[model samples]
Target chain A: MSIFKETRITRLLIISAIILIPIALSGCVSGGSMTATSWPGVTADESNLYIAFNQSVFAINQDNGKVLWRFPVEPEKNQTFFAPPVLTEEGELIVGSYNNNVYKLSASDGHVIWNFTGAKDRIIGGSVITDQIVLSPSTDNHLYALDLASGNLIWSFEANEALWAAPMVDQERVFLSSLDHFIYALDLATGKELWRQDLENAMVDTPVLAGDLLLVGTFGNELISLNANTGDLEWRFKTEGWVWSSPAVYDNNAYFGDMAGNFYIIDVASGQQIERAQMGSPIATTPAIGDNEIFIVTEQGDLYARGLDTAHPLWQIAIEGRMLSDAVLANETLFVASLDADNLVSAMNIESGNLRWQFAPEK
Target chain B: MWDTLILDPMINALLVIYDLLGNNFGLAIIVFTVIIRLITLPLSLQQQKSSMKMQDLQKTKRWKDLEKKYKDNKKKLQEEQLKIYQEIGFNPMSGCLPTLIQFPIIIGLYQAIIRTLAVTPIQLLDLSGHIYQSGFFSIPSSLLPLTSNFLWMNLGQPERFWVTLPIVGLFGIPVLTILVVISTYYQSKLTMATTPGDGEGQGAQMTKMMSLYMPLMLGYFAYTFASGLALYFVASNLLGIAQYSLIKSSKGSNIDLAPVKKSVKK
Candidate 1:
């Protein structure tokens, strides 16, 4: 026999093996580290730090990290929160969720005030509450402005891409950076677009406002500065990796970290790198500034307290889980939120980097 | 090992083609399949030659005699076959090798489609890591949301029944599963039809069953998995048919589905 022969059984077995192996292997190769499970969005009033994390919002006591209250008080299917809660002047705590709803709860206790399910997609970004309207940007590519009292839709401004970041309200203009690679500034009252500037790539952070300067970081590895009122380009600073850490403006410099782990303090107007510090991991949120200390948290759960002016590390500490949310400063303590499974929020002493208190959601 | 060896290269290659083909993912998959078929043409030819040689050997008097003499003692029949196979310097498993090699490519291509589509943030971040830095085939920032909207379908979604198509209106008829099923049937039939069913050790029986079973199995996959994978299946089966036809024509073999027609072989 001058040929190769295979049994029909062998062919069937080999084909079955071929089919089964990849299905098994492909399961392992799926995007496993799919964004941190907990992205702690933290905001503070004078007495308590309100955090939206892991489907529930909590108002932790500022003096001692005890859970004042937890929203829903029960778990509901598909209702998870990653965006931090915002406190309105009238004391309404507004937070967004993966379940395509913006929940309004009483800040004093986690009681359901109202729910805004107008946004067609999940509300991942923090909602901006003004005198009359509650503006929430959603993954559905629309920024919904609801009446603050009734939770009714005032109007909606649509973008070409998913709106992953909260809107920046500066005076009469509301600025929003979209994952569609455009930053739109709209008239606060009418929800009419004032100007839209193309940033060339998706931006997932809220645009930072500093007087006339508006800074936005893009996944395209650039930090763009635009005139707050006009939405005109002021300066563009290119980074080594994606500028995911929203810049913290202080004095004359803007401090931020790129996805490549390079932390920089850049002069806002000059577009010059003031100082560079190696953080060794991707920074998740904007640097929080309080009492001369600049708080920067990496996605790996490391927190570094560097001097706001000199960009020198005062102290650095690692939390149990990844710190994906902005840290709130209340008095002498830094309130850090963790996307970790066990701990929800931890408060650390500002100068010493010591653990003050840890707040865990009741299981 | 899968990522560095197979998936990374396939992803970069797909992104390159996607960029070149006006960022149309469907066209990119088709062109990529054609290029892959062209590159692996030598392997297919070698495998086809080996299969034809096996079929011819089975039809010969010596093989029939061996089967008759060792009708009860299967071990003796196998020893005789191995001795002949060694004497001839021909390998039966060689035909299986190319197909075994193709398993990774097929799986890698499936994964690459999903990764390039980048439906989630982490998926996009993963894609960014695998991107080719060179200008030859790079996804520019302008193509941020590489719209999976190809031929009226979101390639990342399942091929729907067209009743809920208004929700997926960007896509066309969603006939990818049907096309895959049809192409799979033809491709399988082309191979099974060409092979002479030597009525030895249930070979003929298995071949007859496969003509129906394989298409349904592949169609089941096409119906459930991402439409992009279904597109790959349809493209791959069609190209396999064309390649088989080319080989058959070159060898002057009869082109017909023997069981279906009942006239091509018997």
Candidate 2:
């Protein structure tokens, strides 16, 4: 009987160990990296970094790369970062999350200034903050403009399909794209549709403003430049794979990569491809531009810092996991958040590409 | 609830595998299922041992004595059984341990699937942004734009008769369903047959009834759920049969039915 008891206890212990070891290992792994897949828009307000991830807004120190404070949002399940938080002229952080709600958080202590609930779909596109209004496109297929101070809904522009791409606020119009294959230019104050241009396929990337042209990428692998005023097609460049990454306009060139690992540097004037750089893995995050250096992180977690003009690698840092979020540049420091690596967020020196500080939230 | 428990995970797991395997959802699911089974093996073995011991105890004379002692008294019977179980260091709750363990896994697996095979814009964006595209089989382009072309199902949505018929008929009959029912029946029979002691006959009788009842219950479930889940059930049952046969053969148990004998009068 004792022998049987011993064996059963041993079996229980073994089973427990088997189950617990993985959980422990997973905890350790998760703790080592800030590798959250949800792209919480990373915005810096001089001294602090505001990141929206998994129903929480984390305020981190710009210098040491430490989390100062975290404010939790309610409705936990499926509550994720949809659009990157926008820093408003009023100094409040405005962001929309997957819970079908938009929150205005205090930049200093990470407190909710106010929150407004929209339709049921998640808000994946980052909020576009203007001087007086904040606009966010949602999976509910509506472009919502809320009062920057009170969190009151001003107006909403409905689309045919869900809007995953963040709306870009220009001088008079808010340019936004949708999975419905249309780029809409709406009046920023009134939420009236100014003009709409139908792309060949769904637009999943946020439109970037380059001079008078609004540059956008689509699910159909087309990079289109439209006249920001009339929504007229300026130029379009075709690629072999889907374009999910938001295009970054630097100098006279628009740089973007595709799902097939091909990076294109297109001239903003004509939409003609000037240079194409192929990386080892697919490029999913937007490239970070600093001075003459352009840093691009791949889905495989390889960070390549190259000369903006030459496309020659200045330095390369290989994170252990895939890079999900775009790298942020603040005060000569490059902050990268990955979902695959043990460290969730890491600070690298802009010049030397040396590791400065790292934080893994789950660990 | 359905989206969280079923649709989302199924899609997510498929997308992860697709991203990893470049769109081969079938291979991804198989590999994922294998990993899950491997993880759950210890719990499964523990449950199996507990079941075997319970069967063994039921056949012992001690059990019969207690039953006879409490034949006319229900409360006393309960107390007596508890006392016997305490003495023997047996827990009836052991039978539920495996089920308890499986519940969370089922939820997790469902989540993985939904996250992987996300077809809609919202689903895809949510999925693509979250999961690591690292999987064994590349998601096939043929399924892209994401089609429900596996047998008779559009894997993106719930399984309907309109979708399942062609897939079912493609096998020249509903052979998969038949195999599913047969394998389930035999697994119950094998467990019943292997139960030690005199109660084996009674256990076998119970097993026979269960075998008939379970298939019907499962058929109803199959009709209602997405064909992906039905496919999963069939795969799991087949795998169970193989595992059972392997264990039985290794244990040198010939699970063939024995002839019932008349009770000898002293």
Top candidate on lDDT is 1
The TM-scores of chain A alone, one per candidate, are: 0.88, 0.87
Candidate 1 docking class: acceptable
DockQ, each predicted model: 0.24, 0.06
Off by over 4 Å in 2: A1-37, A73-78, B1-266
For model 2 chain A, the run of ten residues with the poorest summed lDDT: A26-35
Cα lDDT tens digits, model 1, A1-363, are 222236753557555754675564345233222324346778988888887766577778888888788876876655777787888997878988878898888887778788988887778788888777899999888999998898999999999878878888966889999878889999999989889898888888889998788999987778999988777899999887777657888887888988778888899887898888778887767888986889888878889988777667799888987666778887888888776448878889999999988888776
The alpha-carbon deviation from the true structure for residue A248 of candidate 1, after best TM-score superposition, in angstroms, is: 1.6
lDDT per residue, candidate 2, A200-313, as tens digits? Answer: 576777889988998887766678889998999988798856677888888889888987788889899988889887886778778999998999988888898999888888
Report how far off residue B29 is in candidate 2 (Å): 15
Ten-residue stretch with the least lDDT total in model 1 chain A: A28-37
TM-score of each: 0.80, 0.61
* Each model's total of backbone clashes: 9, 53
Candidate 1 regions off by >4 Å? A1-81, A85-93, A105-113, A318-350, A354-363, B44-61, B71-74, B134-139, B156-174, B177-229, B244-266
